[model samples]
Target: MAAMIGGAKPADAGAIAALNRAAFGGEDEVGIVERLRGDGLVAVELVAEQGGAIIGHILLSWLPTIMDGRAMKALALAQMAVQPGHQKQGIGGGLIAAALDQARAVGAEAVIVLGHPDYYPRFGFSAALAGNLASPFSGEAFMALELVPGALAGRQGSVSYPAAFGL
Candidate 1:
């Protein structure tokens, strides 16, 4: 499949919400994503398109953390979803890569994701807990990646994602 990864356009909102609902097994995530977009908190919102149709979506939002008494921009990878028929076809991966690239381009210090450990680690994610970072929920599902050398150095604190996450 030939897929193009690009930033979300205004026209893509409905399609993106549909993909999110289908991929996440509900509509709750759709609202959260929309809210994030409206609030200008989405650092990067990427979509995977094939043949002029959107098949996958991913969102990275501004998650702030106070470490060493300083506030820093922490990229929060959330709501990654590929259409049911498009799963395992690399659309999800493409979306993630695009989002990460955008984050790096903008000089984000670190990225955090609450996702499947097996899948995210392939993209350089590691257990945030090991680095003294904690989430509202406990487990290896919460992970982090430092985008710059020593970006996470001496940083130890809890992550605070947007309230829309309900966490």
Candidate 2:
């Protein structure tokens, strides 16, 4: 059956964790997701379903923008996973696309990701845009995408992950 991308249902949590485990071969992301869920840090969550079964999950959580101990608002892309059998079949890409649309619709200024340097830029995420920003995951993997034109321009600060991230 063709996969459908949609907002996650409460019942999908178990399947989401399973997909994360299968995709990443670890429980770290699942634990983080649980923590973020409990802490209300999840700004967006998308899931892919095929044959009435969940197969992929993606989340965008809120991250504080910290400059000299002051806090602002931002979003962070986290814990994206597609089931092992579904990898590279466009499910992950679709989930990202849908999430970005929602983010822009919600007036998110920018979105950050600590993800594959190669894989994420296609979605308009740029390490250059995030260059001056400080974070534990800085380097090629740390990237930002402007939902508003030049959202990160002249904005230099560290990303403050919520307690759920253990940062």
Candidate 3:
């Protein structure tokens, strides 16, 4: 069966929240998403649907990072989740790929994600510490991928996600 991937509409509010809760095992991330949405920092929220049911979701938000004494627009990939029944079917991968494409279309230089090292590497993410980037939590969980040529070249700094992320 083919899955349909697209940006989430306002009408998808409940489905998005439910996807998050199932993915992360709680409502905390759902609240963070709601806050980001209300604060106008959500660049894009994507959902994957199969058989008329939402099964996956991903969120991209503005993350400010300084490189060479200048600030640049960075995208933070967060809240990626797939419904329990849909796990390991590439739904999450499709959602992430779509979100990254959207980010690139908007001219975001780089993208950062806090996720499993093994999983994100497939998407071209590597240890951000090599580029002098670190997250509020730790260096290991932070990863980055340059979407444009030399986007991460000479970039170094702490990443600041939207305040709604509570990072």
Q: Which tens-of-lDDT digit does each residue in 76-98 have in candidate 3?
A: 88779999989999998899889
Ranked candidates (lDDT, high to low): 2, 3, 1
**Candidate 2, residues 89-123: lDDT per residue as tens digits?**
99889999999998877767789999999999999
Worst 10 residues of 1 by lDDT: 129-138
Which pairs in model 3 have colliding backbones?
Answer: none
Q: Candidate 1 regions off by >4 Å?
A: 128-131
lDDT of each: 0.82, 0.86, 0.83
Clashes found in each candidate (C-alpha, N, C closer than 3 A): 0, 0, 0
Over 4 Å off, model 2? 66-72
